[model samples]
Target: MHKQRLVIAGSGSTYTMGMMMSLIEEKENFPLKEVVFYDIDEQRQERNAKATEILFKERYPELESFSYTTNKEIAFKDADFVFVQIRTGGLPMREKDEQISLKHGVVGQETCGPGGMAYGLRSIKDMIELVNDIRTYAPHAWILNYTNPAAIVAVALKQEFPDDHRLLNICDMPIAIMISYAKMLNIDVWEIVPEYFGLNHFGWFTKIYDKSGNDHTERLKSRIIDEGFTPEDTEIANDVSWQKTFEQARQMLMDFPEYLPNTYLQYYLYPDQMVEKEDPERTRARQVIEGRQNRVHSLCDGIIEKGTAKDADLHVDIHGVFMVKAAASLAYNLNERFIVITENNGIISNLPEDAMVEVPALLTANGPKPFAIGEIPTFYKGLIEGQYAYEKLVTEAYFENSYQKLVQALTLNRTVISPDKAKAILEDMMEANASYWPELN
Candidate 1:
């Protein structure tokens, strides 16, 4: 058995740390030849590294063992897999992305708003470095990119590394959506055969069946068509009410006919749609502001201040399951069905040949070969080219220091109002994130 050399790029992130701890406890899941944690922020990652060391010492002492490092060459060399979960601008930048987009009358969610576009600018650079690291060290390694603005990042990678199936971008929203679909159909998600496609969060359910040939969409559609229309129900978050994804899927069933839309598509489809100032339903932003922010900050502060795990507690972490599982399947050649982002390569016949597409793919020794998604909606067809232009152009600009191209990428974001506003947002964000994107010339 080939021992896997796994390197997690953003090892300092709370989520990444949680995942490392998780792997330590679930010794059976992470059978790595070596686990390497890589991050540039030594002051921050060292703490998580210490905690990881302590836990492994106390628990999974028999495992192959782990090492944390700031040197990409040392850490990533000979790696089998590298999991990336970086926030290019960190917390301050996230807030700035939201505040700036809101100022321009756009919905300002972090991962879905102008903030996402802003973050994408920085991300394309990081992706480039990760690609370079692979070139320098683990040429055979597969990168599982779980970073923000997944759609944008995937687009950049597909164009840049056209033949490098070694790079796989993934998101868990589809997994959750599949599970929800299973609940609606009274079957396990594993048992349901779902044929789905879209850009990232914005695609939809097209075909549904069981391996045994049971059609499940009919049952799902009948319940949501308001067949027994409720009069007193306006609450979107009610238990009987659907998730944001289900609501969007319900809406898409009207015109598309073949598919139901995903929530990520909301950004592209409904640029002017009014989200409530105070959403009664759960929003990741509010969750961040109210809970995640405080908790993550306190966690960081505790480590920085204490220099020990005296106050640290083991949180049941699952993120490692996502990263390692993908790599394990690839290593073992299981060809598991995964929602991965890869170059279209004729998968979606309508999109550009280089466009990054998120669809069901099977991993093999060679890499991902996506199933065909015949054609997307006209509106999505309209969307694909314009978005791809920015994704490609931005990557080019960052690589070549093309300021004009960077501006073009911002203008194409769709959320940017005009070229003038584009300049303002770009300049302001670049200034605000000088530490992150200092290459602007």
Candidate 2:
């Protein structure tokens, strides 16, 4: 077995510990000769680096080597796989993105509506830079990107590096949803194979087959319609906000019973309801800052003080583990099927060939081979087309630095009802994100 060198781009993130634990758990299958952590923030990265040192020394003494650095060349050199999970402006700017949109009466979410557009523009530039650096330093390395506003980032990457087969864009929301589905059906998640399609955050599960080839789509749909998407037991549903998002799947089913909808569709299909539920003063970003952010930092501080993570209260992020599995599948050519974000290329006969769609694909050493979903229903087609237009325009706006395209993108969003409201939100976002976003004409 050839040991691999892995690089994690946003090593300072709260999710890094979970990812480290995941690598520890799967070390037998995906042996790592070296692990490099790279982040721009010196203070935060130092804290995380300290915690990581404690974790490896206490838990996995057999691991060959591990280190953290701000040097891109050192981090990216000779890496077999580079996992990218960056936040361009971090949480403060994310808070601004949400509040600014809410002030204009739009659904204030980190990965949907106007907030997503704002995040997308910032992410495009940063992601492009990361891609370029990775290609330069480790030309043959596979870049498994789990960056947020994934749909837009995927589109921008497709436009920038149309021939770069090594770049694979993915999200864990579908995997989280599948875990819930597995709990609902009283079966192991790995025993179920799903047929799903749409852009990131906006998608549907059309079919779910058991290991015995039993089609359970109707059964799952009936349960969701009657009792909402309440899973019997899953870590993702533990949070009150996540629980509510799961239950809202009932409303989406009621509106369109043809397929099981992604929880994020609530933002698009019921923007008014989303607005009603949001608290402008304390948006989701603030909640994360108060919750996960504080807790993770405190844990890091404790690890540094004790010089050991043996008694630390670190929790595993099942979502982060999914990315590890993806990397393993690619490195070993497991050909495991997963939902990935890739160019449509007539996969959906109804949608544009250039749009980046999330669908099931067989992961191979060569990269993801997406399964064709054919044509979708007219309702879904229309919704997907509208959202894709907004996503594509966001990429265009970033590349062209065209303020007109930026406004047009906001106006096309389901949350924004008029050009005036779009303009207001765009101006506020521009002012708030002045330091991050490119100057637009």
TM-score of each: 0.81, 0.97
Cα RMSD to the true fold for all candidates:
5.2, 1.4
TM for candidate 1 is 0.81
Q: How does each model score on lDDT? A: 0.67, 0.88
Candidate 2's C-alpha runs over 4 A off are 231-235
Error of 2 at 237 (Å): 2.9
lDDT of 1 by residue, 1-441 (tens): 566677888887767656766566544644666778888888667767776666565566665768898987888888877888877767566777676666656656666645776787778888787788767887888888889788878877766777776778888666556655666666766576667766665566777788799787767666656542221211122323235445655555654555545646666566666344423234445456556545655765575566554567546433455456566668778787677777777888888887777787777767776788887778777776776776677667766777788778767867564788777767767776677763767
Report the number of the highest-TM-score candidate.
2
What is residue 141's positional error in candidate 2, in angstroms? 0.7
